[model samples]
Structure formats: C-alpha cells, structure tokens
Target chain A: MTQESAARRFVVAAIALAAAAAALVGLTLLAGASPIDALHALAEGSVGSRAALGETLARATALVLTAIAASLAFRAGVLNIGLEGQFLAGAVAAAAVGPLLSGAPFVARAGLLVASALAGALWVLPAAYLEARRGVPEVLSTILLNLIAAAAVSGLVRGALQDPRGDYPQSRALPDAVRLAPLVSGSRATAAIVAAIALALLVTLVVEATPLGLKLRATGLAPAAARAIGLPGARLRLLAFSASGALAGLAGGLEVLAVTGRLYDPFSAGAGYTGIAAALLGGSHPLAAAASAMLFAALGAGSSAMQRDTGVPGALATIVPGVLVLTVLAARARLTQKRA
Target chain B: MSGFFAIALLLAAPLLLAATGELLLERAGSIQIGLEGTMLIGAFTAFAAARSGAGPHAALLAAACAGLLAGAAFAAFAVAGRADPILVGTAWNLVAAGGTAFSYRLLAGATGSVLEVKALPPFAFGLPAAALAAFFVPAVLEVFLTRTRPGLALVAAGDNPLALEATGGSVVAVRTAASVAAGALGALGGALLVLTVSPTFVEGVTAGRGFLALALVVFARWKPLRLVPGALLVGGATALQYRLQAGGGTGIPYAVFLALPGLLALFALAAARGRGGAPKALGTPAP
Candidate 1:
C-alpha cells in the first residue's frame, strides 16, 4: 500500500470510528443510561488516573507484541492464525518453566522468555506442516488448534497445574524472582511497555533496512514470481511462521511476567485475536501497530468502566472494538477497490 | 449398535448441516469463515425464542433466520463491500460472541444464570430431526448438484467467475445468495446444538463445531457425500468423549478429550492430500 492510500484508509477509519461512537451513545440511551456519563466513565477508567494509565500501557504492551508477530507473518505471505494457540501454549510453558529455574536471576528471566517462545513455535508446527506438505489451508488448521488450546488451557489449569491449596482453576503463584518488577508502584504497569516499544522500533528497522526483510516482503507480494526466480519461498515461509510464533510467545511471556503472576484459565482477554485487529488497523506496519495497540488497549481498559457507570453490560464493551474494526473495514473498502 | 449410531449421528448433525451449505457456498466461489459467528447468533436466537414461548419448530426457523441475517451482514462486508473475508469473518466471530453474551446479560441479568429449556425431543426412531436431516440432505443435495442446471452454474461460477459473468451469470448474486443460504445452515447447526444435547443454553456452547465443519469440507474435498464420513469421524470423537466422561472419570484430562477432534481433523487434512477439489477462484474477490 502506498503512503497516500494508507492515509486515505486512516481517514476513513477515523470517520467510521466516530460514527460507531455515536451509535454507541445511542445504544447507551436505549439501555436507559446517560451517554455522557458513560463516556466520562470510560475516559476516567482509561487515562484519568496514574494507575489507570499504567494498566492501559501494560495491556498495550502485550497487544503490541502480538500485533507485531501477526504483521510479520502476514508480510511474509503466511496468515499465522495459530497465534491464539501459540499465545496460550506460551503462557502455559512460561508458568511451567518459571519454577524450574532456580539459578541466576537474569538467566531465569531469559529462560522463561525462551521457553515460552519455543512452546509457541512448536504449537504452530502442525499448522505450518499441514500447509507446507499437504496444501491444507493454514487458516483452518490454526483456528482449530486455537479451539483445542482453549479447551486444553482450562483443563490444564484445573487439573494438573492447579494450586492444590486453592479451590479455583488457577496455577500456583509465580515466585517473586520470576515476576517482572513494576515500573509504576501501585499499578500493574511494568518495563515490558518499554520493551514492546523498543521491539516495534527494531522491527521497523528490520523490515525497512534489512535484506532478509526485503526477501520476506517479496515472498508475500509475489510468491509465484519469487519461486520462478528461485527465492526458496518455502523455507522463508517456515522461518516467518516460526518467528511469528516466537513473537506471540514472547507476548505471553510478558503477560506472565509483567501482568499475571502465574498461569491461569482465561490467560488472555482475547489478546491474540485482538493482535490481528491491531495489525490491520496499523496497515500491518510495526510502529503503527504499536500505536494501534495502545488505542485498542485504551478501549479495553475502559470497557469495564463503561459497563459499571452506565449499566451497559460487558457485551457493549466488547461490541465497541468489534464495531470499530468493522467500520474500518467498511471505510477502506473503497480504497482497496481503487488500488485494485 | 443402534445407540452408538444414534450418538454418532447426533454429534454429526450440526457439522453435516453446516457443511452442506458450505459446499454450495464454496461451489459459488465464496468462503465464509464467519460461520462460527453466524452459528453463535443462531444458537442464541434459537434459545431466546424457545425460552420466550416459541415452539420447537418455530425456534429452529428463528435460529435459521438469525443465521441468514448474520451471514448476510457478513457477506455485505466480505462479498459486497470488498473487505478481506478472513478479517471480516474474524470480526464477525468477535461481534457474534460479544453480542450474544451481551444480549444474554441484558435479558438474563449480569449474573448470567444458565437459561434452561426443555430439550427438543427426538422424532421417529429415537433420532433428532437434525440427524435425519443430515442423512437425507446430503443425498438430496448430491442429486441436486449432479443433476441440476443451477448446480452446474454454481460450480462454473466458482471455477471462473469472470467466465461465468461472460456467460451472463451474476457472480455477486450467486455468491451472496450462497452465503445467505450457508448462514442458514450454520444457524441450523447451532440450533441443533442447544436443542438436542443440552437442555440449557450456555455461552460458546457450539464450541468449535463451526470450524470443525470447515475442516470437514476440506477433508471431504468439497464433496457432500464424503462429508458424511468426515462429519461422523469428528462427531464421533466429540460424542464418544462426552459419553466416556459421563460413564466414568477416566484418568485422562477432559481437555485432551475435547481437543481430540481438532487433532483428528489436522491429521485427516494431512492424509487428505491430492484431492485437489477446491474452486480455483474461491478466496480471490473480483478486481
């Protein structure tokens, strides 16, 4: 996509979002709530306080990582739909490995990150193999795998990994050493936000400056041509898939270290899926993905407040982001046609 | 033996229904990955309608209509509006899930107490209408597709829409109609899910059956006849595990049992190589 078209899409998205917001206000009225109050509550919950701001940043940090992973795979001509499964598996793997590492502090943290990344990559293996060997659609396989992971996560947390002392289906708490220290006291925010931003910068540089990035983009843009010219398209795809998995896994790792202190059922609040939305919203560009992730995170962080202040229910909370994405898609429909 | 067959058919009912419609949609060169979302809508509407005094027959119709509407909304963006099908489908999934859950909250309260209703009883020979429909629909469709002119036209549209357009067929019309019909089938699956196995509706009760149906289509090589065994295979995995869990708490984790069908589908897809039956222009929207 050219810069002009990208900007056009953004403009369309902005208009669509404003329309959606108006519709939401109308919805709040139908539900017998004060729309102005609801908006105020949403604003307050997202960034009104230091703690609220910190939480939003923390959520944004994980979203940015996952979105970057998604955009990377998409740029390489592979739709890595297995990120949900990868994220879940990565979270579980981090929890499993964290307690096992009793060595040096830095080594333990790095070990957690690496183990999560590997677990995520392995989780994506079956989908990758099916596409590579059997021409099976990766989209279907990955989606199925995500369903399996959903069922499996609750089972693992409740059965094998459950803390014996607790009645709930949650893992044992992470030791103090395994947890990432918070950047802001009295809030969930941690230095992972910095890491996420840094990673986005690094990804931007890699995609724009590196030969490897060029090859991946080339493969995505024209797989047939790349193969005709002997670009080892297959290997590049596999590499892209693995890298996507690793990044998704890293998001899960940060979630465990910086947000959740241990493995648990419902490990993520659809963070993996939202990553896809973030990538699309950002035009699949790394830095833009980070920005969009923050936007989504704010929406997410404020949803609860929208419910609490207006009696709107959690459904309205979920509907807003979905409507936003749908509107964006609607707005860009014309631009894509023009490009075609 | 009869009981086992009944259980298999019961589990396969939803998958079979959705796969049938999906075959037609695929034949018309459109893939609606939003079937899961559409199913969720159907499941909720059917349950709500039933709870609000609709008869079982009416409930099923309501579900199917809801599915059709949901599917149409999806196609408006996916087919007409020129959005990427995958993304549109994913967004639809989230919207349906959230919308249904939200609706339940508004109607049932924030507590989300399980809404109970009597299970729709089996008909002749102790089998659900869904199960019977599964058996007969494919047979009827197989004949209709093979013998009918419209079926051939649908196939032509899928293989090469541009050519079909040249031949005076409206590609958009065929795809949009197929998408709507497919949504109805997806809703039927969801309605069957709540009406048969469970006496109450729960969030995400369809689980991943919609996607499993998609996988079945792939495994069947887009052939409706082949989908029977494919549906039965997955349905059996799901049905048998529930029975196993009910019979006794085996030492195995329940999650492993739940995930069995997914693994089964993955391997089945891998083993289904060289079938080569996909419509050539399936995912590519018109320029």
Candidate 2:
C-alpha cells in the first residue's frame, strides 16, 4: 500500500501485460502468421494515418463516456456492470427520438440527449432498487438486466423500429440534421469526440473537486462512517447508479448520433465490458479512464487492420485489454495481500 | 409432443452439463463467472481436435481438459490473488474468444473447407449421450452432495470457511479444485453442444447459455434437484422459438422467444431474493 509497493505492483502489471502480448503473438505465429506483419498491421490500423486516427478517436469517444460512467459507480464501491444494457437503452431512445423531432437541429439534439439519459437511468432503476432494498448484489442483477435489455432492444428493433428496407434487424436511420457533424473530413470522427472530452473533464471535476464527490467516495470506503456523519448511504448509492447509468446512456446515444447513424441491435458490442477494464486501468480516475479508453479504442481499430491484412479475426485485439485487466487485478491483489 | 419433448432435452443438455460443475464450484465457495468463456474454449478446442481427426470421445476429452485448464487459469486470478470474480471471469471470456477466433482463422484460412467432425452417435432410440447426462447429472450431484464427506467439506467451504479451516480443511484447495472441475464440466457442455447438436464450432457459439446457467444456479437456490426445472425452463423457452419458426407461425417475433427465458429468469430472481439466499462465504477468498 506504500508508494514504493504501488510502483512495484504497477511494474509487475506492465510486465504481465507484455508477457500476455508476447504469448498472443506466439500463438499467432503458431497459426501461421508472421509476427512482423501482425505488429505492423496493428500499428498501421491504429495510428498509421489521419483517417485511422479519426476512427480510433470516434470509438474512444464512446469508450471514454462508458469508462467514466463505470469509474463513477465503482469508485462509490458499486460494480454497476449494467452499462451494456444502459448503453442500449440510450441508443434505442436516441434512435426513436431522432425520428420524432422536426426542423430544429438544436431542439432535436437536446431532446435526444435527455431522452437517452432518461432511458439509461430507467434501465438501471430496477437493479438499483433491488440492491438498495432487497440486498441483491448489483453484479448479479445488472448482468441479468444486460441480457434482458439486449433481447428487448433486439425485439424492439425487429418489430417496431425496423428499417423500411427490412434487410437487417436494425432501426431506421436518423435524419441529417440529427446527426453529429464530422470533425474530420474523411473519417467517421464527429463532434461527439469533443463532447466526450468535455464530459470527462466535468466528471473529473465533479468526482474529485466537489463535496458530493467526497461523500460518494466516503460512502464507498466506509458506509458506516458516512452514515454516522449524516450522509444517506442508500440514497448516495442510488444516485451513483443513476448518474452512471445516465453517462452510459449518453455514450450509447453518441454512438448512434455520430458513428453508426442508426441503431444496430448489437452495436454496444462489449463496450460495457471493455469500459470496465479501461476504468480500472485508469485507477478509476476520469481523465485516466478517458486515456485508457482511447488506448482500447486504438486496439479495436488496429484489430480490424489485423483482421483485414492478416486474416486474423478482429476479436484477437480484444484479448489485449482483457489480459491487461486480469494482470492488473492480480497484481493489485498481490500488493494488497502483501501489505496486509 | 414426444418430438417436442426430445428436442427440449437436446436443448437442455449443454446447460445441464455446464451448470452441474458451476453448482459444485459455487458449493465450494468460488463463483466462476467465466463459465461462458470456459464453454467457448471447450467448443473450440473440441472442434479443432476433432477436425484434426480425433474421435468424438477423444474430442470430448480434449474439450474437458481445455475447460479444466481454463477454469484453473481463472481461479489463479479469482482465488489465488483474491481478484474480483466478475473481472477475472470477463477477462477469461475475452481470452477464450480471441484465442478461438485467432486459431480458427489460422487453421481455416481462405478457401477453408467445411470440415466435419463425427457427431456422438445417439444411444437408444436416438437419445443423444448428452440427453442421458442431462437427465442424470443432477441426480449424481444431488447424491454426491448429500451422501459424501468431501461434498460436505465443499459446502462448508462455501458457508463456513473459517470453521472448515479450523477443523483442518484447506479452503483454498477445495475452491481451486472445485473451480477446475466446474470449468471441465462447462467445457463438457461446450463439447456436448458441438458433438451432439451443431457438430461444429462457431465463434461465440455458446451464445450466453453459460450465463443463463448462472441464473439457473440462483433460480435453483443451489439445489441439484431444483436445477432440472431451472435448465429445462430456459431450454423449453428456446425450443419454442424453433417450433414457432417451423410452424410458420404468423405475428410471433423470434426476439420474443429469445427474450422469454431472460424475462422469466429476471422474475425468478425477484421472487427468489425474497430471502437473499446464497453461500455465505462465496467469492471471499480464504487466507
């Protein structure tokens, strides 16, 4: 728990991560791939050019929001893993609202944002209630809610929000006015990236610099202490869940409004899971979470290149963050054990 | 109706297999949330092994071994270092997915042939081997838990680790062993899926059945006898989707069929948690 031990733990985690990557490359070689080609493809895909950078940033935009959302609740000692469900709730809401709004772009965007956040909070309400009153572990209820939300959204898209073309199990496209304008000329990156950055800053400010933030952290660290000091434990926990849900929903809404332009049933695509790693990697610090989200986003971008050039499945890239998270958790545990 | 019953049994086989091991592991106080990943790794390993000309029996063995290894690896983080089970479990899933997809592409590159492996030949009257296991594994587990000392030790690991340790039991050993066995069973479920049903490996093929089994554990309240009803209910709901598709039923969306079990499980959670029953020391690593 000392600074020296923390540093040592960080070094060990970094080493473990490097070893996992090395093992992955070795596995790729066993699969008949050239190590150089795989590495090159990864590099080229993530930061090789302006377009690739744009794509990576766009993906990171969503990841940043979700990771911060995760960090917020986790810092409050709540493992709110229902970000995936909450993400879907937001996306579906945005997709639905996009079609409802008429001429004014500002009104449409504002309405879509509120709708997404409201829907996200609504999605986590049941789990929050259960955890608060029934003593249900948030991990269990949220995961169950994730499956249900996925199925519900899939059903909604297929039945009511089906595109007129009817070729895919997806929602109708948003109008041009409702879409976030591209920040870069040739890439998918949009103004949402700026939104993500602003939100990250705001989150850091709220979580680190505010009295409420102190209360939330105290609630997580010592609920009894917080309660003795007149803080309402259940209410604070519920607020954290609701706020996290809103942020997760905003991430989903941003993806629909900026990147996909339509609601894809599987659009969340494990972002919720990925965001957890990102948050943990950042030590649950908002800015750090955003940075790690970008790191994961690059990994995701590089993976597509790996898939295209090496014929390796893009999912291979997802393994790196997973490995990082596992190593980090293990290293932290070792440190804590040793300290105790 | 008999055909429907038969199909539902087939549907329930993998879930039945996977949940039994998870039940054992949980009984021993470690919640291996990575069962889905374990199954995926099993399915892929079995498929790869079978494609290389291993017999179905050999394939199943390979799958179980893979599952055990995967489970042990997960436990190394979950039980060894006292990490969060959800975090460790999620990592295991990613590793399994990436490893399977990476290997599959390498082996089955461009112009890959549709390699078929031998399916497990059914026993009496086309009842697959898995169907037999599905029918009886619960009973075996039930008897094992109630009639054996080791089983009692496992239960003690879950509810009273300190007491068990005070009486000369090693909580870590019990949990580690239970976790590995659980992984092996989940892998067996994966093997059962490819060998008896699909007879092929697909990326992400377990399709949340492993996750569904987690709910089954909760729904059954950790009782082996109750698991049958829990697994079958989900299977029956899934089977309904197939029946609706085959019947050309109008106005019924497949999504409803898919979400049916999920909704049912959610309600079950609500009902079951009226008392908040689970092993007391579950997920808490022993010193």
Candidate 3:
C-alpha cells in the first residue's frame, strides 16, 4: 500500500469504470437505441424520482448484506461460494415460519430473522464438514449445495411449503402485520436497508480496528506462519464461514419481509453471485463493497427502466458488473506482475 | 427396461461430453470452474445459429467454434495473465449468463415466445448421432492420454510443469492448446443438448449440467474411462425421476429425484477419499 501502488490502483479503477461505461453505451447502440436516451432513462429510473430511489435502496439492502458476507469470508481466506445456497436456506426458513407465528409484530420479526440466519448457517455445514474432514474443496461442495437448495425450493413450493390456497408453486405469504413497513410513502425502501447499512459499518469497524480481526486476517494471509504462531486457523475459518452464512441468510429474510412476501421457486435473481461481484469490485473492503453493492443496485434499477423506456435490455445490469470485475481482476494482476 | 436404458444413455450424452472435456483440461493443470458458463455460451451459439437458418450440424459446428474462442479468452486471463482461475471463472459465469440473456432478448425481441429449432436426426434407439458418439469419448480420451505424445506432454505439464520447462516445453502453450480442445468438446456437449433432446434455448438451458460434469470429473478421480459409469448413474437417476414424475402417485418426494444428481455427486466427492487421483498441478498457474 505504498502511495505509488495506491495511485496505480486508482488508475486501474478509473480505467475499469470507463470500460464499463463504454460497454454500456455500446450495448445500448447495439440494441438500436440512442445511447443518450438509455443513459437518461438509466439515471431517471435509478435516482430521478422517489419511487426509483426507493427501488434502488430496496435492491441495495440485499446486495449490501451479501457483499459484506462475501467480504468477511474472503478476508478470512475462506472461499465460501455457497452464499447462494445459504441465502435460499434462510429464505425458506422465513417462508416456513412467517406464516405460523402469532405474537407482537416485533417479536415475530426478530424470531423469523433469527431462524432464517440459523438455517443459512446450517445449510453451509455440509460444505464445511466436507472441506475440513474429507479434503473436498468447499468450492465444489458449496456449488453442489446450491443445486440441492434450488431443487429443494422447487419441490417445497410444490409440496411441503406450498400455498395450499393457491395453485402456484409458492410458499404461504408473510402476514403484512409481521412484515416491515416502507420508510417512505409510494416507495419500496424499508428499515431493512438501514439495518444493512448499520451492519456494514459494524463489520468494517471490527475488521479494520479489532484484535480478533487481526487474527482472522493473519490466518488468511499466511496459514503456515499463523500455524507456527499457534493461531487457530480452522476455527477462524469456520467462524468466518458461519458468520458469512448468517449475513447472507439475513439478506434473504429481509428480502421476504421487505419486498417479496412469499418464497417461490427460483426466488433469487442471483443476488448472492452479484454480491460477490460487488465485493470483488470493491477489493473485498466491507464499506467499499457496500458502496459497490449500492452502485450495482442503482445499475439494476436504472437498467430495468432503460429497458422499459429505450428497449436497451435489462440484462445490462448483470453484464456491466461482470465486465467491471473482469477488468479489475486483469488490471490488478498485470500491475502486481509489473511490481514483482 | 430397455426404454429406460435408451433414455438414460441419451441424457448422459451431454454430461459425458462435458466431463471428458473437463477431465482433459484439469489433466493439463488448468481447471475452468466456469465450465457452466462455457456450456451456456455454446448452447446459445447453437441456438442462435440454428435460428439464423443453419442446419443442426452446422449449428453444432458454430457452437464448437464459439467454445474454442471462449476457452482461449479464459486462458488469456487465467493462464497467460496468471490470475486466480477460480475468481476468473466466477466472473466468467456472470459475463456468459448476462451476455447470452442480453443477446437472446435482442434476437427474440422481448416477445417471450417459444422458438424451436430443428433437432438433429436420430441415429439409433431414438438417440441422436452425437449422443451415441458421446459415450465413446471417454475411451478415446483414455487412449489419447495413454498413447499419444502430445497427450503425455499435456499430462506432464499438469503433473510437473517445472520439469516440462526444464525439458524445453512451454506449460502455457500446452495448457492453452488443451483449453482450446476442451472448449470445443464442452461446446459440442452443449450443442448436443439443444440439437438432441431439448431442441430449444432458454436462459440457463444447460441448467446445472456444467456443474454435474465438474463433479463427474472428481468422481472419476481424474481417470478418463471412469467417467462413463458416473455419467450413466446420474443419467439413470434423472431418467427415473422423469418417469416417476410422469407416473404420479409415487410416494417418493419429487424433490429427491430433482436433487438426485447433485446429491449423488456430493456423495461421490465425499467418498472419493481426499483428492486421491487428482492432478498434482491442477489449478496451478502456467509457467
């Protein structure tokens, strides 16, 4: 982190941003629309009005939490790619419990979110066990878990968690009495976004200022050296892994409480994966990753509007994040190589 | 029973092809965790080509070409550029998924309609020629790895890249070449899916087949010929699930069948005993 390297990093970020912007414009042109119209629509849709800003914040709630989840694990040297599975597990938990609870709204909400977080942590146990005991790569096992989770969701919607009152393959909806209310009238933004921001700040403080954070970073940065010093590498990894799962699970629970009232098959639009992209773009810093997630949320909100207004295709939301990450990865690698 | 076996083999075709390609790439010491993305790229290329009036075989060819390019691009980042393969692959999935979806909407014009392309002509037992040919790929790979000089060089590169370098060979070159070939095979695997049984393109049409193929390689313990039984097992399980779904009133839950392949793959990894036969230099940066 010398000044020169920091300057280089800034340059890399600038170039990557420029490239992403150019790609967006190119894609808009390819769709036979004027780039100016697409940009106008994108800005207007993401931040132009109250409703649009609300949409962006609502989307940011999940992305911010998941981004923090990814950053936490990555910072600890554990590649917990099963965030997607854990997220679904949490959503399923919320969907299952939200319908059955009867109590004060605050108590019910707390109970449901806790259950969802525990479910998400539980979902990752198999991957963790396989990796530690059988030497199986968590990468493969977690991905397999994702597939299993997706299958389970598809089945539960039809059988176990099915909304018996309706023919659709979806779980029973959460009662509005138990769900979070909008922060503003005519907008989707909720208290969940505020909670997400608070958590991000807390995690940043812990990682950047605490002794426990040093131990985790030490384990991640140098396993052998940490082992020589008698640090509990495995325990730290497990802690990070579980905590990461809990964060993602919380995201899923909030999605249900704040946005979608019910869990359906394929409920997520790859929120976990997009969150990982945000973390990568932010270089895995908690606060930076949260900012990146918010940026992505804006992109998603704006792109859908662009698609509606200028026929630019909403998939740009997915593509632009990917391109930025790829550019960042290549640039970082090249710079490191030159320094070495 | 015979009908079940026929359908099972047909279903196993794509997995077998993709797994074989993965085995080759891994054997060369570079793993593309983004094989799913590669397959999606292939599926879309075939669909787009066929929709644009190419015949089935020509579409397959187009898909293979796209895969070759995809493989080379991946090598540019993960091999030549020495970036983390796993991270590169994770991003690759996003790019491929979003790229195909964007292109599909552009091509289909937001109609959200079902546009079917012509399927390949059946070869035997109601299987396409490509599907039947997919079963023999493992044996071919086995022979290639054991008997061919280039294949041995590929293996050498994977097992001991420094030694290969001492002997005046470029690990990057061998890996890049292997990646290109693997890319073709993986794409063909995807094309066979659309041109044989499915005959249509959807977002994520390959589903988790790419992942299943990755599992198959690990289950096979990096052995070329061992992939057949594993692929057939998954295929049979899937076929049985379909049969059970069609014949309602079975007491077994439908989710179990849907999860059978992934569950089986997970079990295989757990049972495989600590990367016993994995390539020594698998996922290592090319020298």
Best by lDDT: 3
Whole-model Cα lDDT of every candidate shown, in order: 0.81, 0.82, 0.90
Give the residue spans of candidate 3 off by over 4 A. Answer: A1-5
Which regions of candidate 1 fall more than 4 Å away from where they truly are? Answer: A1-7, B1-4, B248-253
lDDT of 3 by residue, B139-213 (tens): 999999999998899999899999899999999999999888888888888888888768899998988889899
Residues B172-272 of candidate 1 have per-residue lDDT tens digits of 87788878888998898888888887856777778888888888888888888998999999888987887887886788887788679988887787778
Question: Candidate 1 on A213-307: residue-level lDDT in tens?
Answer: 88888898899998898899999999988988888888888788788878887777788878877877676777777787888888777767778
DockQ of each: 0.63, 0.57, 0.77
What lDDT tens digits, residue by residue, belong to model 3 across residues A205-324?
A: 887689988888888888899989999999999998899999999999999988998999888898988999998888888898999999999999999999999999899999999899
TM-score of chain B of each: 0.94, 0.94, 0.98
For model 2 the TM-score comes to 0.95
Residue lDDT tens for model 2, B1-287: 38787767787889988988898888888897778888888888889999999998899999999988887887888987788787788677777777777777776775556666799878855766656766698899889888999889989999999999999999888898888889999999988888877887777788778888887888788888888988888888878777876786578776677678777777776667733567888787876
Two-way DockQ contest, 1 vs 3, winner: 3
Q: Residue A33's C-alpha lDDT in candidate 3?
A: 98
Clashing pairs in 2: none
Which candidate, 1 or 2, would have the higher TM-score against the true structure? 1
Here the TM-score of candidate 1's chain B is 0.94
Q: Candidate 2 chain A: minimum summed lDDT over ten consecutive residues — where?
A: A1-10
CA shift at B93, candidate 1, in angstroms? 1.0
Q: Name the regions of candidate 2 deviating beyond 4 angstroms.
A: A1-9, B110-116, B248-254
